[model samples]
Target: MMKHGLDPGDRRRPERLTRPELTARREAMERFLHVATPQLDQLYNLVCLSGCNVLLTDAEGVVLDQRMSEADAAQFRDWGLWQGADWSEAVQGTNGIGTCLVEGRQVTIHRDEHFHTRNIGMSCMDAPIWGPDGKLLAALDVSSARADQTERYNRLISAQVAQTARAIEAVFFRASFPEARIVVASDEGGDAAMLLAVDKDDLAIGATRAARRALGLEREGAIRPRPAADLLGRDDDMSGFDKAERAAVTRALARAGGNVSAAARALGIGRATMYRRMARLGLGEKQP
Candidate 1:
């Protein structure tokens, strides 16, 4: 293990774990990789190319997958950034991948945020990736020395890695749990707040709790608990099911029905603008 100096106030941290706890986390990751699959390897490769070293950890901060660029890998290894490592702040001190995961958000913990002596030279950015029902899935992290990087680019790179990680998660989820409902929660708003679910065949089912709330529903309205093409203008192909997919949905609904209120509600659209769309689409009587 690498050792370094503990600045004033760093010596008294109670949250730090002993060496054995760290060793346990390290061993767990080794066990996880022993049975790794192709999809997991793909996820690791994609993350590795995204301009940051990526570390996939469990709910606990045990590193499951790690991929760094060859040059960075060498440097990281010199810093003792090996594959089987305990990423938790409690074990290795306050670094981004562990601490951001511990706090459950996208976090940047630069050098001084470290609570232990060994972590003081590293700068890291970590984003928490959540699974269905909002369970923490894994984390995407980038780490380097403070002397070699800048704040703005670091944040931008972290965000990019986070989104890439999320996409990998989406693909994995859709494939593994094909029948289970999948809801995407976006940090983007406006039309970007759109929510749509899919059935086992990947057809549009309906929205979830957050989707209904984002669309301004008082409670879970008529957007059935099952897969239904209740959304008025929704196409048979369901291309309009995402925010980027909405324009097509709106156009299709235009051809299907003219009633704005009727169509909007079905499409997870808010009521106030349903009338406006009805006027725009020149709709007649509402669909039954």
Candidate 2:
């Protein structure tokens, strides 16, 4: 079974961030909302479907825009929250968005993470959004009533919140620079070999600084255009590969449970070729 607090919504874990540690995150959130508008609205709507309240905060931990259930909205308003409310721990004490910003990782804080007694009825999960230069961009948070009987409901909402955060990131990335390929580099390890972002046309968009270094580029460059087979080591047998290579690699990796060697063998390719495919094609560490 999954640990309660290590990865997701764990209630049994030790407390992570102190009150003062959240100051910087709170400032960042203050700045993010100043510049984000229409897209922020879309993000709010995306999380609303999960029956959770979504908050868009800057690095500083201030609440910019909030979307909540009808009753919850009324309660929040009754609490005197307006458009410019600051929910940072320094101001409001520990909470999901605030703590995640301070911790700088994805986390789930069941009611207990809240510093205030009133907030204990909520379960909140959050992930930090990052910018192109890898600076903290914003905090995406989802909060729902913990009194609900179903753990599945909380899990579903948490997943939706995470997806919404990614969607906002994708939209922000594309909107900021429509021409730039938005390649996703893995958040873990900062590996030069992994490429995370892919364009709609199935082309690799951006490569991480580490990846650029591995690719032998002096400076950062585009995600690089290479056939799916080239990355997966099937390039040598071009005649045997076709448009389905991407889908094939994806499914193979999934079936192999993320074992690249198994995926390669299943595809009749050497393990080395599989590695090349992972890097060249920009597949990150994820099994999918």
Candidate 3:
């Protein structure tokens, strides 16, 4: 903070983005914003009675959208918690949304934990949201300026913020691959959004961060397209793969009206390979 020439006692804040700049940023993050706005609304509906404001900010910690009770709007706006406000750790110093974005995790900066004395009255809880590509995407925050709020209660709200962030990530991931099949890689650590997008050949097209780590898949850019079964370690047992393959071939054959050539084409495979697999799997004799 001192390096940024910030003096906690001075009570100064960074300049917020102008209307045009904010509009441009929103346009850049339109996809993420489109998916997260509705979640913030839902969260607000559940939290409105608690006298708090729910905010969604981009990776840079600039507030893109917010939901607050109209009764407290003027007060929160005065505290710089409104739309277009820049609360990055570099700008605001040791706050909830900004610090969580920087740390890439959940956090709560309660009351006097704020670097600036003017912000000491508010408590903020936050969680970092990751993009479909497994990069830092945004921050979800719930800020309460209510004087009677306690740190214990803030922790409860903190959990809600983190859950909402995961929901946003899952929605964004599914939206990113509308045509692909989404499969749950694991129920464990699913709060990290362990999801995978697979293609027609059962190749893993994309994976959420937790899914990527669990599967030992690609860390950046497009995945190299590994088989989902292989990633799940199910390939160690050919019995399972055979059973699944048998089912797939049977379905394709049925769909093709029992024509081997049509079934091979439908399965996106060569006729020779299809016949060989059918024989190995003890499938019925092939048609002429």
Candidate 4:
């Protein structure tokens, strides 16, 4: 508020973007908007089941799309929560979308957490959606009027929102690198799945956020387009053949639920061939 020259007690709405400015921003985000529109629609639909409103914004926190029920539309609009509104930290203070973008992670801002007094009745959850290059592309936010609820319940909802954001990031990553082979990796208990993108030459071109974290790529400062073996902790050099074989076998097993015969049939290869390849690739004991 001090940076923006606003008083602490101010309840005035922030300045909105002009028509031309909004148009330019939309045009700049055309590609991302195209890729995110369908996913955002699905996300909005899913969240609406719980009477929540969904908002999609670019990295700068300019609203691109929003979904709200008729029951809450008027109230939200009155709060200036609509398409093209600016919700950056500079503008809206400490709201969910702005704080998530600032922190580069998921956040839950409930009631009094909001800097603006007028927003004290709102509860919001937001998570950043990252591109294949590990850059912030956009954010996904779900918000509703504050309600009396246990902290545990609110945390559960926050987790759900973060999961959905990760799903969007994964989808966006796959779309950005459609030609790359996607290798699914999971945590110890196999509760979460992360995607690693390997090029035809067995190089790791990209990874989803979860994959990056699981593999410790960020800590290692591993240059992107690096060797897949480096991230996977494998010493053997991965030939093109090895990468292709592993990808095929992993996908087949995933589809077949670890049934070697079914996986072979799906790949149009003999069961013996599948078993031999799986063993060679060190994937024989790996469960999908």
Instruction: Give the per-residue lDDT of model 4 (tens digit) for 1-288.
Output: 677664545776655678888889889877777777776777777667556778888899988778889988887877777888888988888899999999998899888888888887778889888766666778888887536644566577777777777777776778777898887755353523377888887788777766777777662333368777667766557776777678778988999898889999999999778777887898874334
Query: Candidate 2 residues 21-53, lDDT tens each?
Result: 445444554444544555456656765654566
Q: How close is candidate 1 to the true structure, as a TM-score?
A: 0.53
Q: Pick the candidate with the highest lDDT.
A: 3
Between candidates 2 and 4, name the one with more favorable lDDT.
4
Q: Global CA lDDT of candidate 1, please?
A: 0.55
Between which residue pairs do clashes occur in model 1? Answer: 231-266, 231-267, 233-253, 240-245, 258-283
Question: In model 4, how many backbone clashes occur?
Answer: 0
List where candidate 3 sits over 4 angstroms from the true fold: 187-189, 236-247, 253-279, 282-288
Q: What is the lDDT of residue 86 in candidate 3?
A: 93
* Per-model lDDT: 0.55, 0.58, 0.86, 0.77
Residue 152 of model 4 has an lDDT of 61
The local distance difference test score of model 4 is 0.77
Error of 3 at 154 (Å): 1.1
Ranking by lDDT: 3, 4, 2, 1
Give a tens-digit lDDT track for model 1, residues 79-113: 55555555666565567777787787778877767
Ranking by TM-score: 3, 4, 1, 2
What range of 10 consecutive residues in model 4 has the weakest lDDT sum? 184-193
